[model samples]
Structures are given as structure tokens and as C-alpha cells.
Target: MTRAKLFSGILISICFGLFLSACSNGESESKDTKKEEVRTATDAMGEVTIPANAERILAPNMEDSLLALGITPPAQWAIGTTVHNYLQPQLKDVPTIEWDLPLEQTINAKPDIIIFGSPGSIQNGKYEEYKKIAPTYVFKEEESADWRKQLQVMGEIAGKEKEAKAVLEDYDAKTKEQAAELKTAIGDETAAILWVIGKQYYLFENSRFAANVLYTDLGVTQPEMIKALPKAEAAWNPISLEALSDLDADHIFLASLPNEPGLASLKASSVWKGLPAVKAGKIYEMEDPSNWTSNGPIANNITMDQIVSVITKK
Candidate 1:
């Protein structure tokens, strides 16, 4: 073979090798880009890097905020057979997940991100275990308490900040309109909320659950009985029927589960029957107490509608 021909053949081999090296490097760079598609977010547990485009989200009790932001989670929060009935219209098809979020069930759900309602919700020191399945974000106690703020934080986590802001703005406008209507109907009459579950009775303090929507947002006057009580330490605080005899509410929003024995017991009690709201026929019965007992954007909105509808009934 001629030397020049042999040199040309060697040159062709070198060019082919370089071509392969460039393609390999390009492929590696593409993979790295895909791997880096995440953002560092500060949760209650501190900085956590989560997927920028998380698709399969699992926020148990905060489903209302998720739904408000137009996101559907893989599972709804439930305790055995109990689930938030008011939210079932939107989340009926979703599977039920334990309130504490069991490991095997979470793994089966295949969540890309798991946003917990509060640090307390991350029980049994299983935060690390959940991290193995997907990124986890936890809300602080105070942050979890305020549903509006919960909505905003979840929005930031889900990359829907604008949607969160818009939701609040629209909700503010809605409350403003409804507050005016409520003022016209009730006219400074004090209102209180009574939640009956089974044989237990719980009362709402001024800022707990949907009571915040009633007295704070919608301008419903808080009864002296409710105002005298301390701010609620938990979602539900039991108040005895005897203590409730002192209630000076002109209107009482009675929230109870269907077929609850507590309602019958309360109705039979002379103290309950003698209450001013009951005597005046101002006892507004809310058959579905799901929203009143829970807190979130969707929950609060439904609560507002429920209060307005009952107060303005012709």
C-alpha cells in the first residue's frame, strides 16, 4: 500500500474516534441537564430540593389547597372509613391514604413529592423513610393553622405562586360581596358554631376552623360566649351542654354528622331547648359538617356559602 494512502486511512480512523467522543459527551451533558431539573425549597424541615415539575403530589390534609391550585393528588386523607365528605365531589375517584401516611401505601401511591400538613403529621420519625420514596415538605404548626398561608406555601412548592395569589384575590373579592349580604340579613346578630359528632359536642372559638370565616371574614358578630373562651388549642375543643347554656348567640350554626346520636341528646336536653337561638328558630343545621370542622381554601369557601345561605334564607 502507498504511504500517503496509509496516512489518509489513519486520519479517517482519528476523525471517527473524535466524532464518537463528541456524541458521548453530548449524551452525558443531556443526562446531567435532566438530573438538575430541581429547585431547593425551604420547608419546616429546612432546605429540600424538589422536582421543578412535580406531577404526582401527595398532600394529605391539604387537599383543599391543592384543589384550589388546580392540582389533584393521588390519595385523599382518610382515617379508616372516614374522609372529608365535602371534598368528595372533587376527590371521590382518588384513593384513600391513612392520616399518618403509611410507608407501604405511600410507596404504592408513587408520589414525586409528599407535602405534609404539619410536622406532627410526620409521625414515628418516618420523615427519612418517606424521603426515600419522594421529596417531603412539612408545614410549621402556625403555617398549617392558617389555610390561606398553607395554600400559598403549597403553591410555592408546586410552582403555582401566581395561581395562589389569584385565588386569594378572588376569594377576598367574594368575601367582600358576601360580607355585605350577610350584614344585611343578620344585622349585627351574634353567631356561634356547635359541632356534634357521635355523642361528643365541640365548640368553635373565634378563629378556629370555619369560625374564622364567619366572624373574621364575613363580618358575623361573635357571641359573648365564644369571645369569652380562649383561642382554640386544637381543631376541635369539646364544650359541655351546661357551659353552652350561658351562650348569648342570636344564631347558632349547628354542625353535625348525619344520624349522630349527639344531636338527638342535645335536642332532648332542656338546657339546649331553652337556648335563645333555638327558641327564636335561629338554629341553622348543617348536616354535612366536613368543611366547618376542617380548614382550607375550598373548605372555607364552602363554609362561607353555607353561612350566607342559612342566614339569608327567605
Candidate 2:
């Protein structure tokens, strides 16, 4: 009878151990489910529920805005054969997908949230499909082009509003400090920016892109040629080569798209060679094509650093 009792006790102890093991596994699963609980985000398309503290993020087209917000996505969107070279060091090994991401590709990446520069394009034919895969957010039409507003909305969605505001404030302080230094370095010297795309020559107007960096941040004087034109409604617009002569600023900032042979052709034009900035060796060739045309707080910081390096070295 005693031997029988000992065997029964051993069997009961084994069952208890198994029960405890099962309960521990159940608790772990409960914690994981809690971590993945859905949260709400409102965008142009209305409210969408996404995984809280999204472990993986994918922005097919607006990687610039995300990077500017200090959020590095799992992958960046690629346009044709081009990627953002200016952000190379930060995104060195990050993978890329087509601008209009394929459903299968996006699914395989397993993004908890997806963002787009413009997801409302019917022609893209993937907006709804993307929504099916993950909680997608699209910037409003008016705010899409404005980087400041983009950052604000992005911060709201990512729970980084305070960090975003701090970034902007820091940028403002840096700009003010740089402007003062630049004033002492080169007082009242006017500057102009020229971008060449294919056969077209474009001059940046007041209050955007490089102009925002040059005139607003660095406090560089705008050439009368740019001032005479109306405020910039678009980022860039076509200007005749004859118009290039009107940009008689003391310093000229020049840049062109990658693999663009137009800079050579523009220089070959007697009109370009005869410009005052060129003749006086005051023309500066901007190295990074990415930030020179786009506007974002981080891009603006890079713009300031590049220009200051050149001017201070001189």
C-alpha cells in the first residue's frame, strides 16, 4: 500500500509541473498580444488602426520626411534606378522597394505601418491594396509638398511630436547663429541658385528650397533678378538662358541632376560663360543634388553646412 501511494504521488507531481509549464507559455503569448495591440492614427484618408509602437515601418515614397524626423525606416522607396544618395551613410544597408510597392513585396516585408507621399493616385492602383496589407497614411494634398507640415503630421502619427518640435527649434537657433557668422564673413553679397535639368535652366525664387536656406537661414542677400520675379508658387520653373544674364548676383550656387550632361552644355553656351558670377569665379557647384532642390529641416541643415563650409573656407 505504501509503495502504491509513492507512485501515485510522483504521477501527481509530474502533472502539476506540466500544468505550470502550460500556464507560463500562455502568459508569454498574452504579453506579446498586448504589445501588438492596435492604435489609432488619422490622416487624409481618415482613421486607421495600426500596431502600437510599430516595430517595422515602411515609407515607399517619403523616406526623406521620415529621415528628417529622425526615424529610419526598415526600407526606403526607390524611384527608377535612383535612391537618396545624400542620405547614404544613414541608410547604407537599408533595403528598397519600388515607389508603388507591390502587395506581395510589402507583405513579405511585414511593415506594421506604411506611408506614402501621395497614396491617392488612382493610376498607381495600389493604394487600396496597400491599405489591405498595413495601416496606410497619406498626407493631405496641400500639405504633401510642405515639409514643415509633413514633419508635424508625421510626428503626430509616430508619437514623436516633442522630438520634432525640438528639431525645428534647434534648426532655427542654428540658422540664426550661422546667419550672424555669414554676415561677418561676407556682408551684403547677393547670391542666386541655378539648377539645370536636361536642356532646361531653372532659377530658384524667393522663400523656398535653397532660397529658404540662403536668404532665410544664412541671411544671404537675394540678387535683384530673383527679387524682381514674383514669389515662388512652385518649387522650380523654367527660365530662358537670356534670363540667366539677369542673375547678376555676387555669388551663384549651381547644381544639376545626377548623370545630367546639361551642365556641360549650359557652360558651353556663351551666355552662361559670360555671366558675372562665372567670370569672377564666384560660382559654387553644389555637390549634393538631393538636398539642393528639396525642402526639409534636416535637408536645410545640410544646405547650411555645405554653404558655410564653402564660404568660410574662402
User: Best-fitting candidate, measured by lDDT?
Assistant: 1
Alpha-carbon lDDT of model 2: 0.79
Error in Å for residue 37 of model 2: 3.3
Give per-model CA RMSD: 3.5, 4.3
Which residue pairs show backbone clashes in model 1? Answer: none
Reference-based lDDT, each prediction: 0.90, 0.79
How many pairs collide in each candidate, listed in order? 0, 0
Q: Which stretches of model 2 miss by more than 4 angstroms?
A: 1-36, 119-125, 231-236, 257-259
**Per-residue lDDT value at 178 in model 2:** 90
